[model samples]
Target: MAGKHLLVLIVCLILLNLSATFASKQNTTTLNEATACIDGASITLTFGFYINSCPEAEPIIFSWIEKAVSDDPRMAASLLRLHFHDCFVNASSFQLGCDASVLLDDTPNFVGEKTAAPNANSLRGFEVIDAIKADLEYVCPQTVSCADILAIAARDSVVLSGGPGWEVEMGRRDSLSASKTAANNNIPGPNSDVATLLSKFQNVGLSLQELVALSGAHTMGKARCSSFSARINSSSSIISNSPDVNLEYLQSLQQLCSQSDANTTLADLDHITPTTFDNQYYVNLVSGEGLLGSDQALLTGNEETRRIIECYAGDVEAFYEDFKMAMLKMGRLQQVNGGDGEVRRNCRAVNQLGS
Candidate 1:
């Protein structure tokens, strides 16, 4: 018992030390002098080390962006996460599981005729960025782009969610076009079999193994019944009948998401690992209990993908390392940074400067 107690204490201390190290690494000293290269690239720059004369300006703005939706901490966190959630699997062309049509038609929609929205699998990061950008614009005018805000917000989100802190290279310019066609052609869908999914990831310069690991992000967020309805029911509208799906769970889900419109109850994929940012997502895959058909496909259908899943499921450290690399890769997708494009003052508004 004494030995066990000592072991637990040592592990806790190590974790605490790691946490402190992560915090120190993340809190960059505000820079006041000239442009310093942030991530080794000449274009990368930051303002962390310098003392702010208008210190209240940034804090008030940051705080406003964080709490513009409400005084709630969870809402603040959601603002930080909304950008990623919105763009993860863009379905602009298909509206697969999104309510984008509501915006297109006379019906009232949240973000206009935008191809993404209220999607179960949407990067929850979008909702937050909207609030943050609105607040920041009131303070700093045109100094910050939604893209830079997004990059910062995602890094902070990862740390707050208990993952390792990543170095954010800034100066990414905003995109003028939010192409529904680009999203449809690029974003991988829930029903995609492993090969199709791999091809999609490869298009973005990611490896097959990294593709399997990246799906672990689904472990944290909510999924609309529409997003997973095909897995649960025998409807040709969305998911096809696959041997890999769990029959019993599908029957239960049909009760919740039977509506043909695809808008209904949402399910949390990693119910056990809700906000912890851990490897239980991979572990769940091994149990033949992954929520989406696309999820289970990682462990089934393909031997190489399945083997990678097995490795990640068994080794937590390996999963963490792979996840970090995969995230870095995902963050790089379709970025219109620096010379690529101009920073949009408003994220929702396309770059009129380009036209």
Candidate 2:
């Protein structure tokens, strides 16, 4: 009878332990599902997410960005593009939340997205992000997220570059991993045609109008000659013969993109106003002076895109309005927040146990 009682007691203890473990697993699963099931429109991001916890967060990030851009005006475009690339990769899949995955350094378990084909040698401004994160960490410790810093820096970049400014929704957290495959597959390349560009945008729930507005971002950046050399060299290129493209412009491009200089030379996307954030990108497209195949495709690809190009070309105010709205919408894609993610001590790697 004593032996039986002891056996019964052990059995009851084992069952209780099992029950607790199962409950813990179930809770973890539920939390993960909640984290993965983000709705861009209904996300919990706010205008002043760190107003109390880190009141000086935005000003710190903005000041850093302003000083960086003041030193190198092109840094404004680089930071803006960085934010877009980071968010676009996250928007590729629900599982890949908008965490600072793009900022991750390659680990044994995974390769970083920064070296992926679409991003390799193309994406810049990582150093600026690192610097901003370092400053925030010094002041706020782990209170601010790298993702939020990215969003804010992007906003400040545009403002300093003479573009419209919009309120950035914050409270994003960093992810544990980066996705090289997603970055390569989802990011539209310079050679992408209209259909490809449209599909890529639509995959992230962006509209055709939004696509046009976002492409306006190209107004301030420079493209490598490699991105457009084929257009100048290809037999099918209308650049050499098109009535819309100016002959002097084509000759100049040909000279700039000679075979020997393909990898080293760069061209402004908007030759007329390369440093400003305006509707001049659309104007360039309308005139067939677009620097990349992708840029020119906006005007020549579809009637709808062409109409948008025409509209933006004529009305800079309309482009600015739509660009701001599109940027806000894009920034919300697949965000990870709440208890599902963490604020990394460093932007380039996940926080270690002590560090």
Candidate 3:
């Protein structure tokens, strides 16, 4: 009788263990679903993915996507790829080593390609996503897609670099092709006047107002000495070239590039209020101190565009609302949805080699 009791007790213990394991698995599955849904929504809103349906899927997917980008440095690099393409579109000669055509003036290093330096303007924003990805990897291994990772990383990057914090809906599947050609064709240029900038954004369903607001992103980061050479060289009348930049703030930068040498560094067009996500970019336009050629063009170009720029510049809250809406629109561009692309195990590489 005692032997029979022992056998019954062993069976009961096994049953309890099985039940606990099943419960744990269910909890994990639920969490994954929620994370994915949010990530998908953020990407859809920001990049214009499968706009109609992905709203439900975003929250579920973000956990995995967020983890992949913030956990690994390599994953952050992969995410930075998208931003790199965006930045590349602003100029004709980003990677050409030395393209004199993009020179602002005769400045020595004030060349457009200066941002290409490994330490200068390269994907410094990826650090935020890298930290998140590391934590996610520890909790869930091999469960997230790198493409989603890229989307989230891009959103976080904007906020990290002293801009507005965007609502990043995740669960984006990885992209199979990283088209160098497509990237080159789509990006805008530093010399692009207001009209050109408007046409490009409108082609993708964005508006002129949005174009001006999104340009506010330029507020953060360093510009190569080359980017501002045009303003300085156009006339010695410019104060920056005459007195040398103030030492307390601008002194170190002047020393780094030299005063007499036209190789001077310019703040990101929106640097006056770089850390805050606000209407200062537009306000800068009103003040006649806008940075990039493309930026000033909004004010000086066509009448309709100038009116819109003025409106946004005058009203801070209006700019914030419009900027958010525009950001959501830009994030959804040309995304392939629903089984069109693989959920890449490694964002940098496609599917696992042997698998």
Q: Rank the candidates by TM-score, best first.
A: 2, 1, 3
* TM-score list, all predictions: 0.67, 0.85, 0.58
> Each candidate: RMSD to true structure?
10.8, 16.1, 14.3
Model 2: lowest-lDDT 10 consecutive positions: 31-40
Per-residue C-alpha lDDT of model 2 across residues 58-127, encoded as one tens digit per residue: 7777778878999999999999888888888852333354577888888887887999888898888989
Best by lDDT: 2
Residue 112 displacement (Å), model 1: 9.2
**For model 1, how does the per-residue alpha-carbon lDDT over 1-355 read when each residue is reduced to its tens digit?**
8974575455435434554664564365322212211121122234331113222222333343434433432333353344443334333433221111111211122233235433324433455566666666675665566665655565555455675554444444554444344445656777788889889776556677677766766656556777776566676423344555555666666765764456647666765676666677777777666878789888887998888777777876566656654555555544443454554556665445312
Span of 10 residues, lowest total lDDT, candidate 1 = 97-106
Error of 3 at 344 (Å): 3.2
Model 3: per-residue lDDT, tens digit, 209-328?
567767765544345556555543434343343232222333333344455544444455455665444567777666666655566667777687677667777765555445554555
| Clash count, predicted structure 3 | 58
